[model samples]
Target: MFDMENTTVLDRPMLDELVPSRYALKIGEIDVLVISDGVLPLPTTMLAHNAEPAVREAWLNDMYLPKDAFDWALNVMVARSGGRTILIDAGLGLDPDLQLPRAGQLMKRLEAAGVNLGSVTDLVLTHMHMDHIGGLLVDGVKRQLRPDLQIHVSAAEVEFWRSPDFSRTAMPPGFPDALRATANHFMEEYGSHLRTFESSHEVAPGVVVRRTGGHTPGHSVVRLASGGEGLTFAGDAVFAVGFEQPNWHNGFEHDPEEAARVRIDLLRELAESGEMLVATHLPFPSVCRVAAEGEVFRWVPVFWDY
Candidate 1:
């Protein structure tokens, strides 16, 4: 019963000026800001894995999403606690050659939002994916953009990318080399400040890391608790469509089956607990609550503040 003729697709132009660069929210005493690093236009083919073309069109139509492409916002979180500035992900770096247009603006946006990048004390990486870790470097070098920042990542994730087997395994074109390069760079440049953890660990007071390990070998999520409020920073754990249809895996997932499984479980938990979610690749602001309906879930975006 989907109405194709009534479906309205997103037609907004992709530009940094068109959308607000940052959004702020609070969870307990911790101050959180969702910083924009720019957006990427990805083909719908990258989503809805294993679904028929007709089914894919129907799903997109129902959601009022463009059948041709989707705008994926590269959202990075800045968590301030006890005077310490903690960045969840480094975001895509500012390399014209390496990043696409309108991307790699995290630092600029942060500055505009009154965040002092020099004061960033800790950098917690959800995973070593290019988009997430790209901002770690400066001008394609391995040097830390913030000299005082200590890097934290999952031990398993670090080991996976650094292993010889990872280099041998086939990956999307140029991805293996890119991963190896970044992994080696991090170890060489930030080894002294790098800390690795297994499973769950507390990065700061009321901020915890949970190992998810479906999108990547060491993929994880961060939970922020304050007073009685909670928010989950889900890094590439679920995209927009993936949020509604947890069973439909993205082509970019390291293990599609495992990713789908983890997503379904996490979505159900979030819905039942009523925890707000900050997704990296969802729409602008990228803050939402997962609403469970039968087997599927829906993304209920937080209301805009004027």
Candidate 2:
């Protein structure tokens, strides 16, 4: 008997338990599912380097989050349209040095959802950040994926990783090195599968990826439109704290200033258009709409579809 709901993978005791790891919904004609890649517990300081300690602390306290560190959600998406199945971002695989053990749950969760890697026709990377590409580098992932898999990413993103700049950004020790190494490894192993794009490219009907170049020189976002509904899968272009403090700088940003500009522009556009938004680091399922409230925007999570 194939009881996918009860089947377990990777032998992770916690993963054996039944939990809400996947959410399914439709964007007009396309099928979309947001899977939880678990969470990454990062230092609170990473939330905003430019913010005053007092002001940042006040925001944290108001949100009831711990002052030291908090868990950041890692969300991955799978979209199907026009006979093409696309993976938006690969979740973190194994990063022993980063000490983030909980976040690499994407592969297992996808398996439980009956999503076979071999069926993925295209992979659209928002950027080459480890959290977004590491899962593909996992030991046996390549073997399971089809040899002709077409990976779509911004040419700027592929070029920036050659000599990534970390001077302007702030991150914990060892992160820069780990990120660089993982990206290098990924490129070396999968570069042949890449299909670089300049600014934007359409992968499938109503599914398009556009370069934003803020979070990373190659960072991009995926937009899906079909029938009359629409949605955008923002890859690290926005965060949980971004809604309240849009100007705050994230430690992981390669170019914080440009990143802020990109964030504001995307939020404003979504707010005005009234389209659904999903982001990598936002809450699970991450299905929400942006509300323009004077200066800062507001996040209005879609009422649970179920």
Clashing pairs in 2: 157-218
Q: Please give the CA lDDT of all the candidate structures.
A: 0.78, 0.92
Error of 2 at 185 (Å): 0.2
Which residue pairs in candidate 1 have backbone atoms (N, alpha carbon, C) closer than 3 angstroms, thus clashing? none
Candidate 2, residue 149: Cα displacement in angstroms equals 0.3
TM-score of each: 0.87, 0.95
| Deviation from native of the Cα of residue 164 in model 1, angstroms | 7.5
Query: Candidate 2, residues 1-306: lDDT per residue as tens digits?
Result: 123345456466645656688888889899898989999999999999999999999999999999889999999999999999999999999767667778899887888777889999999999999999999988889999999999999999999999999998899998899999999999999999999999899999999999999899999999999988899999999998999999999999989999999999999999999999999999898999999999999999998775
Stretches off by above 4 angstroms in model 2 are 1-15
lDDT of 1 at 163: 71
How well is each residue in 1-306 modelled by candidate 1, as lDDT tens digits?
Answer: 112233223342332254677787789999888888888766786786567878999989987989988767899998977666789998877656544777788766665666666778888889887778877665633333566667888988888777734422224466667766776775776778778899988888888888898888889999999999999998988888886678776766777788889899889989999999998898779888999988889889889754
Best-fitting candidate, scored by lDDT: 2
Q: How big is the positional error of residue 37 in model 2, measured in Å on the Cα after superposition?
A: 0.7
